[model samples]
Target: MGLSDGFARPLPTLVFAVAAALSMAGLELAVKQIALGTAYAVWVGIGAALTVGWAMATGVEPASPLKLLFIAGIVGCAAGLKLLPSGGSAAED
Candidate 1:
């Protein structure tokens, strides 16, 4: 799409872009308060899942069983990190 295209100019898209940027900032803060491994995994997993979901929902991309399963795997791994007893706390050193 061109820079001035109608699809590119939507307010919601701009809002979402801003939200995504803010979430990245939040990820940096989270790494300071929590273990980097856990924070980074959750940040990347959530970002990927949301991006795929939005693409599918908007019909920008097609959804298939495998795609859904893959997203589930990503989110599950992130959840697993949070459940680990040692990884949820602030990092040492």
Candidate 2:
């Protein structure tokens, strides 16, 4: 989103660059404590949901009940991933 907007304005381009760098740094730190797959999925899911929510809130995108529901689902799933026990065996005796 910022990337697309950045094409029209210069400030957004700088903001996008900074945001991207911060996001990557956070992800790198997250992987140190969380499983790579879980960390990545949660990261992407929350990011996407927030992006869409922001677009809708800002009137850049049309808001719909279905879209809101999906966004809630993404957030819920990310929360679930966070709740799961870390480094647990798939099978137990």
Name the top lDDT candidate. 2
What number of backbone clashes does candidate 1 have, counting pairs of residues 3 or more apart or in separate chains? 0
**Which is the leading candidate under TM-score?**
2
Residue 50 CA error for candidate 2 (Å)? Answer: 1.2
TM-score of 2: 0.81
lDDT of 1 by residue, 1-93 (tens): 223365567776677667868998989997886688779988889889988998899888999999999999999998887666663344541
lDDT of 2 at 15: 75
TM-score of each: 0.69, 0.81
Enumerate residue pairs that collide in model 1. none
lDDT agreement with native, every candidate: 0.80, 0.85
Alpha-carbon shift of residue 26 in model 2 (angstroms) = 2.0
> C-alpha displacement of 43 in model 2, angstroms?
0.8
lDDT over C-alpha atoms for residue 83 of model 1: 67
